[model samples]
Target: MTIGVALIVGDTLRRRWHTDSPGTRGQEFPLLAAREQAARSTAADSTLASQLTLPEKPSIAVLPFQNMSGDPEQDYFADGIVEEITTALSRFPSLFVIARNSSFTYKGKSVDIKQVGRELGVRYVLEGGIRKAANQVRVTAQLIDAATGVHIWADRFEGELADIFRLQDDMSQRAVGAITPMVEHAEIERMKRKPTHRFDAYDFYLKGLASLNLQGSKDAADEALQMFYRAIDLDSGFASAYGNAAFCFVRRLVNAWMEDPKKEIVEAERLATRAVQYGSDDPVALTSGGFTLARLLGELEIGEQHLHRALELSPSYALAWTHRAWIRVFQGRPDEALPDLNRAMRLNPRDPLMPGYFSVMGMAHFVAGRYEEAASWCEKAIQVQPKFLPPLRTAAASYALAGNLQAAQTMMSSLMQLDPRRRISTLRELYPLQRNRDWELLTEGLRRAGLPD
Candidate 1:
């Protein structure tokens, strides 16, 4: 056997080294040519591998669920479940979720979790099976730590098939809600062991996000801006970095922290423009850029178009929905804004930006002439973030309009302590409400709450 194997290897080497055609002689050895071609292929593969390194944030891939209903027709239903789950997971900006097209390549295959992890460059994999019988459907999903092949979470969902869409939504929501927290916990543990010096542009971006999550802190916003700028310096084409930097200016404007208004507004516009130019498909970039354009630069029409495109790209992106609601409020369409705000809250029930959501809800109600409801929402926002300026101003105005003079006075006192320079005359300049009536209403309530002209 050894001798035969040696003869075969010798013959193979001879064929590879010799050119089959005499005309091709002295041009190149076949084996050397093959090796050169392989070298080029290997270089390309290495580049691809570098591009596929595990993302800085928690990343997950959802494989198509098996259709175990004994009917090939049920395949579509199983695929729908995976699609819904993928869309829901994509709503989370902190997660690096793989799209359905890439994940569906593993459909109907018995895959190795570790292989999926290596190929997809993801930390977690979600796989499951669906069974349908009569008017009912059952889904069994398990989330696995791709590197370790350990099951992190598993759940079974059973629902009526009469409303398949609702079932899909419910299942996806439940799965995502459970999976997100697990992934976050795993990421926290992973970060504890990761060396700080291994930082990349994405690491800087994540650090910026961490600072931004400390809502309503001027110091935190400043730190976040620095981190984002560092990320942009490292990766000049980073759309989200530019978008977030623009949003820091928006935060400054909202909180009256801008020391040089004209210069800051110009910088904000420049950053937002670059974000829109480079991030046509990135919902985070679109949301921040569009909001800044509308709210700060007064480019309402273009801003609304960008925001609409963002929603089309990511229907469940909570931040996009929230900003769209804010734009509606600015457009004097409070009735329309309320629904979008509600949708945003539903999509991200535990969002760190809940204070902003509540404040926007209050603004919508206040603009719609529901003073009591507005005050109620503003109070909720204040309770969550006691120093949040927008809610403080809105609460003061809403309370005064709702005939609660004492509460209005108390809120006005807090607002004054936060921004002693606040004056009724500056309200329109700061807010820039599109409708004269809305501006008049806001100023009147502030005046009644004892703000000076």
Candidate 2:
């Protein structure tokens, strides 16, 4: 089975790149436009940090770097650098790093450092700028103590385009060391490891990340998959790209967007396996690949092991925690899932994928027979993403189980309008709930809510 799946994925990848080159796609669909749309959406929904409490460990937010290159097109480069720095810092279990989505909300704005700290619930803020002229680049960064408005550390790095990756590593190390001097030298060395030797592949991966951050939209997900595939074509060892490509399929499964479910599942599983194999030390790859395995392929134990490895690698990775929480829910351990969900929410309160966290929370509650609470969380998820199917299905089932026939029917009506083909009989295939009782509960609730057999 594994060899057959590998051959299928290998053929599909070859055909895809043979017909489509990265150059033409970039011209047809500008990455900048996609990034701008995502930025606007992120800024609009950036309200998760209202009077937040400080974490127990040292916390910091890396704000969007200013583009000093005198070209608006350089915004992506600057933003990508900040995101890389943020990700590198997040690997440390002792540092509480604000997610890129939350920190980038302050882009192109002149803000007081103290206010940024208060809004992000961090003790420190790292702000920087990038200037690229000819084949050379200059970068400057300052670490500020947000509470006292004091500059703790500041530095500048200058290097050629070829040395850009080294410059980024230096900046990440400097920022991490300045914020938490207690971080081990080994951890700093781990942050210095480059994702890819090819700059083009890294660029494509960054573009893919921008598209993935948009979430919810099928078009965005497709674009992200294409970008990741392009990256993989340039650098086959790029595990993060492979992992994210698999996650695009996971999104399709959740939203009922797969045209050929069986084929897509095989492809997703293949991509996920490659991600895990190549990215044994990468948290993003492990988290995405593990979640895809659990949700799409029903490899619950293997997926949980991958997720556990991801958390062990980067305890601050909110998505890993969220994925692990869902895995617990699928394993019929709702009690074990809730705390992980809460921890994820606290780590990255402004994550764009909060609706997903909410939906999984609803599932956990539903599995635990807390019908009213499940309905509430699923309703919140629906409000954020009205067309999302899982939350809508769970909301209907929860309301029906709670004996609110009118609410249950209303939710079912909305769900059916979104995906008319969905039936109670398909629940098992659609959801990988482990326990027989949980399956029966969902089927009964859906039946009560007027779903067809």
Candidate 3:
């Protein structure tokens, strides 16, 4: 197929650069425009962050598929379809998609189209509803104006459950075809809007939520709490945000930055349950709910199930994978957990939390007695975040396992400086393994690393 290059003109969508030489559809988008478009679009998105560096390519968020079937049980079927679509869309390496963590933040939210564009920093948004009965499924999807609250294109997909994958491909193709443009108007589509939505205070709350998820330090956590309060003042129905608020508190506890773990865990559970009640199928709510049940309530099986369901609904979801990976690592099958963490990294390579992913990968290898590989991965992790706990510990442990006591001691000293009291005991308590094998593997590593009993 012969393709020509054409530069898209401002205000009107057209070929950006016209050339006698053929260019792929992706190449047709001017590099500068694509970058600007992503920035403009994210500034429009209402997710948990501001202008994000995208994955391989720009990405759009597909929120939870609405359960239009009026049958509660069929909610699973709808969620499954969205999960499939999210997975398919992510396979393309060109778009930077908001991890489900940020995307699902809008689960119960009524948003301004421009705000969606601004917040997610994407050129488009794809959302739809599913109505299913017995074997019949009807799905409707639309690519919308994240800035103008306008629908650029819409399509309805109807078929039997057996043809689910086909429907997903069709939806992705339509969305990709409609939104993949190089240029249009000076504003593209993201316009600075004066939001006049239902909850004025909630707007600030959204801003705060975005800030907290930036995942840096205590300052971010404090900001998240403040935003949750603001959101509650505007709409108490914002139960989902409340769960997010509790999540911040739980982070404090788990990181040993808190005065009381038990008390904070209780509060986290309360908020998580409320979020679930308010919006059941929401991936965010499910994450919070699952953590509370498993980590706080010690309901291991149910917690695993909830976390599993969350991943099933949003395959490109990094946070869910993070939690799930930890669960597997603790269960003694670091081998099983490796893929989950790898998936998280691929979904958001620019994520500042790269250290965590590397750390876990190293630990998984270390526990499996792959000392050389563990040390290698930990070194890569330290390049990202020097003070990152898991990778630091893994480095020391890997060295010791390889019988390099001097090197192990050196790394241990650094780890101790970063965390004054290196507490293997605390890690066990916070992330108590549901499986005996996971517990044994990790603990055995701690012992090998010269962890004091």
Clashes of each: 0, 0, 52
Q: Kindly list the per-residue Cα lDDT of model 2 for residues 1-453, writing each as its tens digit.
A: 012332222222332521355443432233334444454345334535465789889999999989999997677678888888887888888899887876876788899999878877899999989998888989999999999999998999999877888998888778777877788888887877777889888878877877777666666677677788888888888888889999988888777777667878888888899899999998888999988999998898999999999988888787888899998998899999999988877776665556777798899999999999999989877776677789889999999999999999999999999898888776665788888898889999999999999
Model 3, stretches more than 4 Å misplaced? 1-198, 292-298, 437-441, 447-450
TM per model? 0.59, 0.89, 0.57
Q: lDDT of model 2 at residue 191?
A: 77
Candidate 1 TM-score, true structure as reference: 0.59
Please list the residue runs of candidate 2 whose C-alpha ends up more than 4 Å from where it truly belongs after superposition.
1-23, 26-49, 70-73
Candidate 1, residues 1-453, lDDT tens digits: the string is 011111111221222211221111121111213343333333323323423567777778888889889996555557755755665566555676765545665666789989878776788888889898887888888888998999887888788764544545555555555656554544332222211122255556666665554445566666666666666666777787788888988988888877667767877887899889888866668888988999898777788898898877666566777888988888899999988886665444333345677789899999999999999888877775677899999989999988999999999999999899888876754675788888888898999899999
Candidate with top TM-score is: 2
In candidate 1, which residue ranges exceed 4 Å CA deviation? 1-199
Output the better candidate (1/2) by lDDT: 2
Please give the lDDT score at residue 97 for candidate 3: 54
Q: Cα lDDT of model 3 overall? A: 0.59
